[model samples]
Target chain A: MAKYSKFAAVGLLLAFPLLVSSDYYRHIMILALMWVVIGSSWNLLAGYTGQISFGHAIFFGVGAYSAGLCTTKLGISAWWGMLIGGPMAMLFGFVLGAICFRLRGTYFNLATLALAEILRLVAKSWVSLTEGMMGILTIQTFRSKVPYYYLAFGIAALCVFAIWAIIRSKWGYYFVAIREDQDAAEHLGISAFRYKSISLLVSSFFTGVAGAFYMNYMGFIDPDVVFSLYYISIMAILVAIIGGAGMIWGPPVGAFIMVLLQELFRSAFFGYLPKWISEAHAMAFGILVIVVIRFMANGVVGDWVKLSGLFTRQKAPIPSVTSGN
Target chain B: MEMFIQMLVAGILIGGIYALIGLGMTLIMGVMRIINLAHGQLMMVAMYITYVLYFYLGIDPYFALLVAMPALFLLGVAIQKYFLNPLLKIDSIIPQNQILMTVGVGIVLTETIRFIFRSDYKSVKTSYSSATFMIGNISWNVPMFVAFGLAVALTAGLFIFLLKTDAGKSVRATAQNKDAAMIMGINADWITQLTYGLGAAMAAAGGTLLLPIYYLFPDVGSQFTLKAFIITVLGGMGSTVGAIVGGIVLGIAETLGATYISMDLKDAFGMVIFVVVLVFMPGGLKELTKV
Candidate 1:
């Protein structure tokens, strides 16, 4: 029954666009799917590997610019970014890890953040290379949302599966071991730096793909939109964190919740609420972060039993052999 | 040579203010073992307080400092007590939960300010704002000179407090070892609260001082937050004197960068220096000073 749920969820998602005719809902789903890719990748690095990155936007922006530049410079279809973006981001990931993996915890976080800021600044100023703040614009290849929706769905599914596979693999254990205690992992002869870089590589690749997908779907790119610390970097963290970090299902759950919340606020609850409520969207994200961190440290999925128990007004059931397995 | 001296003097003057900001972060880092990522947001809140007092009440920014500092101290104490302290007891996968909380707090603070002030670029224009005096070949902005003097005086006062006060000793002790401090009957919880308050107050003072010369916006806190941490890192995580020197160095580097290396890349200079310092001299200036 539990094994079939994954299939059920995927099947439902695959059929979602077909069931829902509204372009509005389709666009929201596409955004949610994109976030799944970004959030899951972030989880793989920060949640599983204990390398909390505050600059996932660096890879994200690189992936975005990789696609955007292909159109502007290479004079190719932006679709090529779908192929090139991941690797381009992975390249950045390698450099970032090489420079930053030497530092631990907060220092690593700061380094990633600082590097991303540098990139944002460069992307804004280097007019010859990046078109500066003018941004890269391209015509959307598909007028129908279905094609983009499916692409986003496919990428998200692939990313989740890859992360799931990695976590189940020996590499996953090494990552977790490093997260638990780097010194202990080292004592056990696991090269912390090597595995961390590998985790970052995979993470950046998927995130880069998402960024590229964003370019193709949105049909436009800007430094402020792509490399924004508040909108992209922190949003990725919020997604992984809101869903429950360290769990395979966490980011997917979180991505949906966040995107839905964002849209609801952005549209002022489908025009029911006052427009002023829409302006408070970022503030809402901030408050959600605080609330989640305060009461639900492990997030909804991680504390499912406790959460459900509250609804049922019953003691959270202790896991029996069948349930535990 | 005159231009060089001008830049140097300007750097030192601004560096004094940066030192005050860095001192706040250093104190928090020393005591809490966590980087108060919202250090600059706290300063921003203080700046807003000062701004309100100046704009609405016709009070001087320097005078506004009295209200801003204590108000921010209380705000900081409340945050430490409620938001950060509880996280210490919660079992979570992420060890940097407190730091993450600070980020959330920073966002909320910035957004709240934006909601109120609407992201307008505001500055407190005083009669002395543009007043200057010539000394030798270099002309000094009067406000900058006064701000520098106030920063020095605050630093001196802080040093005396830390060295002479029993409460300050307890703070240092708690920073050294929380468990040991608890065993010694010092209220580690209260000390953490007090340290956070002091850190916030110092940042508030720095912000209040900067109000005359610098422009204010909701997003300004983030830039200072980056600068504060950079200064803290450069000074060596928990070293006060090191932070002061680091601040001055950053001030000089930024001014020089602005003059010679495109004015736009001035902020980048600090970041480049930060990465360089992290890579080569992880110990920061503290390794050399060892104070």
Candidate 2:
């Protein structure tokens, strides 16, 4: 029954664009799908590997700029960004890992954050190369939201599947072992550093691809939007945490909910409510973060039994299997 | 040579205020063992309080400091007692829950201020705001000098408190080892709240001092938040003395970067230093000074 529900959920997502003719809803779905890729990647590193990065925006922005540069500097179809962006992001990730992997826990988090900020400053100031804050404007290939939605869906699906596969493999065990205890993992002959870097590399690649897709779909790229600490990096963390950080399906679930919640607030409950509520959308995100962290740190999916148990007095049936599996 | 000295003086003046901000963050970091990402937002709240008192109530910004500091102290105690303290009991996979909570608090604070004040940049103008004194070739702004003096006095006062007072000793004990402090009959929970309050009060003082020279806006808190953390890391995580030196180094580097390099990349200099220090000297200046 659970398996059937999972299939039904995927089917609903695939058919969502066809069901929703409104470009606005489709646009929201597309953005949600992009976040799925980014969030899942982050989940791989921080949730699975225990390397909490506050700098996912570094990969994201680097991937975006690579794509943007392909058009302006290299004079190729931005579609080549789809090919090059991931690898470019991976290369930078390797270097970042080399420098930052030495630090553990909060230090690693801050290092990544500082690196992302530095990248933003670089992108903003390197006007001749990045066109500075003027931003990059490219003609999006397709005018309809349908193509973008499908593309985002395909990429998100691919990313989710890839992460699911990685977690099921030996690498996934190593990642989890490291998360559980880095010292123990090392004692067990797992090179914690190598596995952590591998996790980061895979995580960064998908995030970069998502950033590239964002550039193509949005038809714009800027330092502020692409490399934002609050919007991109923190948003990635929020999505992963809100959905269920360690769970395979958590990020995608989180992405959809967050995107929908944001859209609902941004559109002032689909224009049913007053306009001023839309301006408070960011505040809503902040509040959601606090409430979620406070009450649902394991996330809705991770704490499904506990959360459902709250509404009903009846004891929730104890599942034979844990969600961690 | 003249340009160098002028920049040095400017850096030192700004560094004094930076030290105050760093001191607050380091205090929180020491006790809680979590970076208070909301440190600058707290300062921003205090600055707004000062701005309101000045703009509407006809109080001088300097006089507003007394009101803002205590208000912020109470606000900090409430946050620590209510928001952060509650999270310690919740079981979660992530060890950084408190840090993430601080981020949420910062965003909420910034957005709330934005909702109330809008995003318009506001500044207080005092007679001393533009006043400057000349020492040979270097010019020192009068307000900057006064702010610097106040920062030094506060630092001295803090050192006295931390070194001499029982409450201060308990706070230090809690920071050093929570369990040991608890065993020593210190109310670790109360000490945590007190430390957070003291940290917020210090940040409030820093914000009030910066009012005359700096502009105010809801988003301005984030810049200072980053600056505060950079100073904390540079000063060696929880070391008060280290924060002081780190602040000065960051100030000098920033001033030099603005003068010699592009002014736009001045902020980047601190980040660059942060990364370098993290990689090469993780213990920061505190590790070197061994104080």
Candidate 3:
């Protein structure tokens, strides 16, 4: 029955574009698909590998920039970005991992954050290559949202499948072992550094591809949009955590929820609410993050049993202190 | 040579305020073992408080320091008591929940300030803001000089408090080892809250000092947050003395970069130094000082 439901879900997603005619909804779905790729990749590195990076935007921006550079500098079709962006991001990931993996915990996190900030600064100052804050604009290859929707769906599906495969493989166990106890894993003869680098490489590749796709679909690229700490990096973490980190289906679920909720707030409850509500959308996003972290740290998928139990069990029994006494 | 000296002087003066900010962060880092990503946002909140007092009440920015510091202290305590402390008990997949919580706190603080004040750049233009005094071949901005003097005084006061006071000793004890401190009848929880408050107050002092010379905006906190961490890393994490030296070094480096290199890359200089320090001298200036 579960397998059938999975198939049904995929079938629905495949037919979504045909069933939905509104370009706005389609656009939101496309963005959601893009986030699925990013969030899942982030989950692999952070949730599975135990390396919480605050700098996924580095890969995403690199991929987008690579694609953007292709059009501006190489005078090639942006479609070639689809081919080149992943490897380029992976190469950067290797360098970043080499530099940052030596540090543990908060130090590692800070190092990645520094790298992202450095990249953003470089992209901004290197106007000769990146065009600075003016941003890079290119003509979209296709006018209709339908083609982009399918492309995005294909990529998201491919990413999900690839992650699912990896998680089920021996490498998946190795990743989990490292996350659970890095020192113990190393003592057991697993090279923590090697597995971590592998996880980061795979994670960076998918994020890069998603970024390249974003450049193709959006037809505009800028350092701030791609490398933004809040919008891209934090948003990726939020999507994974909000849906459920460390769970196979978590990030995909989170991607849809985040994108839809953002749309709902951005549109001010679909224009039924006051226009000023739209201005507070970012605040709402911030509040959502706080709420999720505080109340649902394990996320909806990870804590499904607990959440359902809360609803079903109207009165939670208090433990009697008299027994211990 | 004259220009270089002038830049050095300016850097050292600004570095005094930077030290105050770094000291706060290092204190929090020492106790909590987590980098308070919201450190700058707390400073931002204090700056807004100072701005409000200066704008509406005609209070001097210097006088607003008292008001802002205590207000931030309370704010910091509340954040620790309510938002951060509760997470310690909850089991989560992400081990870095506290750090992430700080990030969320930062976003909320920035957005809330944006909601209330809007994003237009605001600054307090005191008569002394642009006032300068020339000595030899170099000149010193009057406000910056006053701020540096106050900063040094505050640092000295903090040292005395830490060394001589019972409460401050408890904080130090807790930071050294929570279990041992608790065994010695210290309320580790209370110490943590107090430490967070003290850290925020120090950051507030830094922000208030900067207000006379710097522009105030909701987003300004993030840049300062980055600077604070760079100083923390440069000084060696959790080392107060190291933070002071790190702050001065960063300030000089930035000033020199702005003067000799492109102004656009001024921020990058700190990052370059940070990476170099991380790779070569992970222990930071604290290792060299052995203090």
Candidate 4:
């Protein structure tokens, strides 16, 4: 029954491209799907492993910039740019993870966050290569959003499958066990550091791919726009909290709700209010986070799973059977 | 060479305010174990409170402290009792909910301030913004000295309050061990509320002190908060003296970096201290000093 539902869902997702019309709808779907991939991968390190990283944006920006830089300077294809993007982000992620994961808890969070800021600062000041504050404005853009949409959708689907595969494997069990209690997991012979490093690398790979997709789609890359603190906050908090973090669907759900509502919020309010008085969405975004976390901690889908009597409401069910498998 | 000394003085002075910024964050972390990312936003809010009173109401920025401090304290109490208290039940030290929720509060507060007072950078020029006092070979900006003095006073006052007052002691006790303190009749809830409120109030006061020197903006808090986090980490979380020393170190490093090196890379220098501290002396600079 579970296998049937899963296959049906994937099948429907595949068919989504044929059903959608108009560039606007496709644009939204593609961005949402790209978020789906990026968010899912993030969940592996942050959500599943219980090591909350506030700087996943670093990987994304690195991917976008690397891909952008390679394409522009070396005349590399987007395909080639993307090919290099993941490993670059992963390599950086590995270094950062290796250094910071040594710290116990709060220090680790602070370290990643600092690394993100440093990268942003570097990107901002590195005018010779990155074009500095004016940003890279002339990346190639296709008129139709269809190709980007398909690309994003394919990436998002790939991310989902990758995460699903990990979850079903022994590594996933270790990820869970380590997340739940690192000390206990270590006593049982799990090298918590190795697991975290691997997770960070994998997470960074997908994040960079998403970044490549973003620069290609937007055709612009700048520090403020691509690596803004608030954007990171929006996706990080939304995916992990709203979609029931530590699960597969968290980041995708977060991206969907955040992107859609934000679009509506921005568009509707843009012409409605005075230019100076029009910062309501920023306020609204915050209030909405508090409301969501205060109420639906298990997230929208997590809540639904509870309502449907499928998910047992405890601290995320430890896969006892999979632990020893 | 003379310019170097001047930059060094400026750096230490800047570090004073940075220490003030980290004071509340360190206290809260000691008690609550959450980094309070919105702390910088809180400083922004405090600056706005002072800005509105000074610009709109035509009140003195110093006088704005009277309104801002208590107001922010109440806000903190409400936040702690309502928003953050629930997350305390969770076992994780880095309570994800508190971090996210505070960020939300910061966004709302900043937007509200932006709505009321436009985004124009406002600084209180009380006939002393540009004033300087010269010594044998170097000069110090009067506003820098004053801001540093106030920051010192704030830290001193905080330490005194934590040590001397019964309530403050209870809050400290709660941070040490909530259950053990609760067994001795300390209301952990009350302490948490008081500590959070005190943290916000101190930030408000810090803003009042800072208004004369630093131009106020809705996002200015981000600048300080990042440094404060670095200060807190380098000093060790929950250590007031640590925050103070760490702030001074960061300030000096940033000033020298900005003067000697590229101005753009100034903030990076402070972060380098933070990174090095995190790597070498994870316990904090004090720990390394002890060894």
Output DockQ, candidate 2.
0.80
lDDT of 4 by residue, B43-92 (tens): 88888778778777888877787898888899889989988898666432
Model 4 CA deviation exceeding 4 Å by range: A1-12, A269-278, A305-325, B89-95, B289-291
lDDT digits (tens) for residues A32-133 of candidate 2: 999999999999999899898999999999899999999999999888898899999999899999999999988898999999999999999999999999
What's the TM-score of every candidate structure?
0.98, 0.98, 0.97, 0.93
Error of 2 at B137 (Å): 2.3
Clashing pairs in 3: none
Cα deviation in Å at residue A25, candidate 4? 1.6
What is the C-alpha local distance difference test score of each model? 0.91, 0.93, 0.92, 0.79
lDDT of 4 by residue, A5-118 (tens): 767866776777677766676777777787787778778887778787878888888888877887768886665657888898898888888778998667777898888888
TM-score of candidate 1 relative to the true fold: 0.98
The recovered share of true contacts, given per candidate in order, is 0.49, 0.61, 0.49, 0.58
- Per-residue lDDT for A106-197 in model 3, tens only? 88898899999999998999999999998999999998999999999999999999988998888999999998889999999999999999
lDDT of 2: 0.93
**Order of quality (DockQ):** 2, 1, 3, 4
Q: Which candidate leads the pack in TM-score?
A: 2
**CAPRI quality band, candidate 4:** medium
lDDT of 1 by residue, B1-291 (tens): 899999999999999999999999999999988898899999999999999999999999999989999999999999999999999998777778888899889999999999999988999999999999999879999999999999999999998888899998998888888899999999989999999999999999999999999999999999999899999999999999999999999999999999988887788888888888888888889999988
Q: Runs in model 1 with CA error above 4 Å?
A: A317-325
